[model samples]
Target: MKSSIKRYLIGRPLKSNELGEQKLNKTKALAILSSDALSSVAYGPEQILLVLVTIGAAAFWYSIPIAVGVLVLLLALILSYRQIIYAYPQGGGAYVVSKENLGVNYGLVAGGSLLVDYILTVAVSVSAGTDAITSAFPSLHSHNILIAVLFVLFITTLNLRGVTESASILAYPVYLFVIALFIMIGAGMYKIFTGQVTEALHSPIGTPVAGISLFLLLRAFASGSSALTGVEAISNAIPNFKDPAPKNAAKTLAAMGTLLAILFSGIVLLAYYYGISPNEQETVVSQIAESVFGRNAVYYFIQFTTALILVLAANTGYSAFPLLAVNLAKDKFIPRMFTIRGDRLGYSNGIITLGFASILLIIMFKGHTESLIPLYAVGVFIPFTLSQTGMILKWLREKPAGWRVKLAINATGAAISFIVSLMFFLTKFTQVWPVLVFLPLTILLFHRIKRHYEAVGDQLRIASCEAATPIEGNVMIVPVAGITHVVENSINYAKSLNADQIIAVYVAFDREEEKKFAEKWAKWQPDVRLVTLHSQYRSIIQPLTKFVDIVEHKSKEMNYRVTVVIPQFIPKEGWHNILHNQSSFLIRAFLLYRRDVIVTTVPYHLKK
Candidate 1:
């Protein structure tokens, strides 16, 4: 029944041979891998305005400069990650680069920071998308959290269907969003050219909270840095591309970067020329669409696609987080389960884990995009700095052709990204302190997990090398509830072991039940010896395990190997099995952990 539900939700299980067939082409790869970066234009410019607007209309002009700075940073990242895609086509992103070049600890830090950013991508993107929705309707504003959570779950399910399948489904919406924005930008530009809208729609009309200064500009820059959050995803997922993965991925990255630059600059330009101010209720893009095509289908189209692409932006995280988790798992820094692929060949464990974590963040922040923006960029730029730094070291160490130019480019990126990261930390310290605290703690946890895995490996290796302990004979103890077929089956299986001694034991709460059981056993006249144990506390497993312990103590000097055979009744229907006492499960659970004891279950299937 569970399998049926899973099949219906995520489609039928995909075979391993079908994996390569799932690699995405350039267009689909752009939609799947670049959606986050593309979709950031919806909120990235807005985040910049959100900071600049604090100083009122006087500072609104700074949005363009801040955006240009962000664009410059974007170009740096694109160039750096292009190199990354080609240099390390295997695609662990920052984790692989930093770990290989810098060391394991730096790699883990990069990995952890990237993980946190991926989670924030989902939260912030969905929340920003929800803000877009609320802007359009206004009535649904109160339920934004619920709306955002539903969208997160929707995207999660979509991703669980497998990467290529998700790309096919998501491709149209992303393209539609791009088309809608371009049309809106062109239409807005035509309006300005034709002089249909000569003046700014709404002039800034408030006292400046603080005068424009270097600190304010840095804050605005840091806020706008959210635009660059998903830039690394293309590098991280090069293997998800088609034949000639690296070249295809690099082309897609360039294409995505180009689109992002055009859309982001256009939006910020329109917002400034139209004199649009950041609204708590409606977004700046929504206002721009209204200014260009007021309250019409085009306007709603912009809003709808903006909401859609933002929600799908979470797809970047969904796509990258699982792959990153797989890398960490392979290194023994996380549980090995993350390394296992699901029936659909995607990393289901990592996908589902990212889903739940993002949902939690949405709830905690109450789907407020502004509240989440402060915490978003630090995670992104930390890895950005580390990855670029790693690449610099790579170029120097490997000295590939044109290594000097490569080193200079990476050095520029590393310096710029490091400055941006520091600015984000200094400007948003109050809100971002938790993330700063999270980085060290998460890295420490990774080290501890690695240590645990190493310790386990050492113990396993030692055990394999040591001599086996000598055994005198086998003693089989079968716990019986009554002289039923299940118990009879268990005893027969125990006798088949050809042990030195076999004991059928019963634990009874009262003398009456014990007498009845004894009479039944006596009439059967089983070959094995029968022992009865009395439980004053009405506990069955305790008395049975106690007897096994006593037998083990008695045979300790001789080293007799004790085996507990548990007889479990198997109901034809799975749900019916829950109605039974489950004593056999308890006995096995208790004895299976013992060093000297062997536990096994013999099942008797019932027809009805």
Candidate 2:
């Protein structure tokens, strides 16, 4: 049954040696790891435009300068994370760097922040993708959340199948989205050169507000910083790359950063000149494409690829979140279940948790991409700031060959990231407040989990146990249903435990039944003492509990460990299980909960 499920869920199980074969190359790695950043160009320009459009048309010009600023911030973070890739090639970039340089508490903060961000990335990206579809066909609007959830489930399934395969599957759409964006940019540039975009720009322009405050522009920059959210993911998952992992990862980072910058800047230019504004009906990218292509097939192509890439952007979280969770699990910050790989050697537990969380967010927000966007960028920036600061501290203390130069770069990166984080916090305070609650709570959870693992380790310390001496005595008790072959088999298995004393217990609700059992037992001559349990309440478990308590107390004085061997009924067919009382399960529940008692169930297969 288990093997059937494994094959069905993840195909064949991969051998440990196949680990290297699954490592992703530069192009595929770029597609899988950078999907989040690359896909963000779809709505990132619009996010900035959202704030600008709110204060009216004159405030709209702030987008180009904010785009420039966002590009600069993106460069800083990219360069910062490249340092992270080389300095900590084993991947655990944020948590490891912070713990190594800053402190454990700081690392916990970064870890918690990154965990939240990865979850939010899945939620926001999937929600935005669904929004793209509903925009295309308004009749599908009611099904957006359902579609978003299904998308997450599909992505989770792909990731569980394997990292390389997920990347290979998603690479085409990512590249197509990139190509479509460039085509739109090219078309926009042609219109710009011909001075023909003036009319397009005028249509979507709103009434100018009285003034554009500096605070508003800074807020625009903060909104635009959403594009930089996934930049650090490569550093956190560098080990998943092929040989010369660091070099390949660093090159992928460089390529992703350059492409993101160009796309972001070009989309901002197109948004401004084409006069696209935030609307409930369509995205700014859709507006830009329509302006550039005039409802042509190319326009639909761009929109289709845009929607696909947005949905698939959750691939980044799939690639990085499980790796992050595994790092945390290794350090005893989360449950060990997160450390167990699926048949494809992926962190299956983490992937499932991420998918569930993303779906919850989608349902909670009702698939409104606008509702999720503000909360999305805040979680991402916290880790970005923490990781960059951690790197600066690393350079300052290490003083490597190019320590001074690296220190200055990381310092600038850290400063910019910290400022952006502050802006996000102050600007998106209401929408992002849940993370304020979630981050501290998550840190508390990490510490609590660590303490729990520590306590378990201490209790199970084999070094502290006395060895060389065999267990001196064993008291085996068999709870019997009646005079049956199954009871005889239970006694035989108990004899194998080499018990110094074996007692067969029978619970009887009637005196006549007890006498008949004793007569049958005497004739059978079972090689064990028989104890009859009288139950006034006519309950099997009640009489069994009393007998167990008395035996457990007596054995304590004799220095004998108790082993309760019960005859467990095994139904031959699935439907046959419903016909059984399942009393052995009831007894196992009572016995295994005690500290010093051991319960073993010997399965008695039934012919029926």
Candidate 3:
């Protein structure tokens, strides 16, 4: 049954040779990687408008400037990360670059920040996707959290199927979304050219009251920067591409960047011309769609596809998070379990961890996109700054062909990103404090893990082992209940160990049972002697623990080590466990924690 579920959901386990089969081509890679950036155009503009409209209609015009600023930053990141793809073709984004150039501490910061960003990406994308749905149906408002959770589960299962499979499943929605945006832009542009436009069907509340303050303007810029969240994914995932991985990844990155810039600029421009405003229900894009195509099918098509692409955009995090965790694991900065590939060649533990984190976020925030958005970009900009900073340092140190030009571009990008990160940190400090706390703790965890691995390597060094205590004879102890086949089998096992001595002990709280067992043992005349301990109170583990303690103490005085071989019953049928005493488990648990004592489990299968 378990195998069937595994096979059905993730397919058969693949061999290392079959890994090449999982490599994604350019189109599918673009779909899987670019959806986050593309889908942001849905709420990205809305977020900008949301911040601007707080001041009033007069400030609403500032959305274009904030968006263009985000666009400039976006272009800079694209240029900066293209360099990263080629340099770190092995595919370590900010973390690898920073470690190589800036040092281990900087790498930890990049890695921790990237990880937090990936989790937030899933949370923010799922919430926004659900918001899109609730905006369309409105009736599903109460169940939006459930909807968000189910959608994340759906994407997680798809990804667990394998990267190529996930890309194939998710590719079309992103393409459709891109095509839809282009068409929407063309239609909106034609209407503008033909003078076939009107004011927004509804504008924001009242006219401009308080003139825009510098802080408010900068706040709006920070809010608009959410659009740039997923741009770094391609740089991190270059290894997932086919042969000529770096080149293919760079091409895909370029394609995604060009598409995002066009779509975002066009959408924001149309929103401005149509005079769209932030709304409590529906989105700015949804509102713009209504004004562009009225309440017709085209408008509905836009909304539906917006929701489809938005929900699926969480796939970006699903793809990137597992890989990021795997990278950290390879560095010994996280558990090795995250590095293990599943049947589908996905990082199974990492995928499950990301999914659970996303589900918790949705539950905690009640699927409110606005609340999650505030915590979004701080994670993104940290890596952007680090990656670009590392790239500048890379070009300076390597001084490759055309190095000066590369250096200047990366230096500009690094500066811009540093400023953006600082702005987000300052402006969103109250709401983003948890993220600030999480990053430092994660970095500390990385350091701790590194130290642990280093310490383990010290203890497990082969040279150290050879110079250590030499093993001699081992004393083996077996615990038995009565003179039965299970006890007979355990005694035979102990004799096979060739120990200096073998002892079988039984604890009896009742006097008659002890006498009966001793009589049976005498009659059988088993070569191994049985020592019976009478417990004044009804206790098995305490008496057994004392016996092992005595054995251990004697072994310490000499060179011999002790082994407690416990006989465990394996019930053939699941329900049979209730019929058997679990004394073996109790005895083993007590003995297992003692130092230098070897504990082994011997399973005696019960046929009935």
Please give each candidate's TM-score.
Answer: 0.95, 0.94, 0.94
Off by over 4 Å in 2: 199-209, 465-470, 508-519, 534-539, 574-581
List the candidate 3 regions with Cα displacement exceeding 4 Å. 199-209, 524-526, 534-539, 573-586
lDDT (10s digit) by residue, model 3, range 140-242: 9889999999998988888888899889988988888887778789999899889787655324434454767777777778778888889999988987999
Candidate 2 on 202-293: residue-level lDDT in tens?
A: 43344445767778788888888888878889988987999999999999999999999999999988888777778889888888888788
Question: How well does candidate 2 match the true structure in TM-score terms?
Answer: 0.94
Best by lDDT: 1
Worst 10 residues of 3 by lDDT: 200-209
What local lDDT does model 2 show for residue 492?
86
Candidate 1 residue-wise lDDT, 545-569, digit = tens = 8899998888776888888888988
How far does residue 585 in candidate 3 sit from its true spot (Å)? 4.1
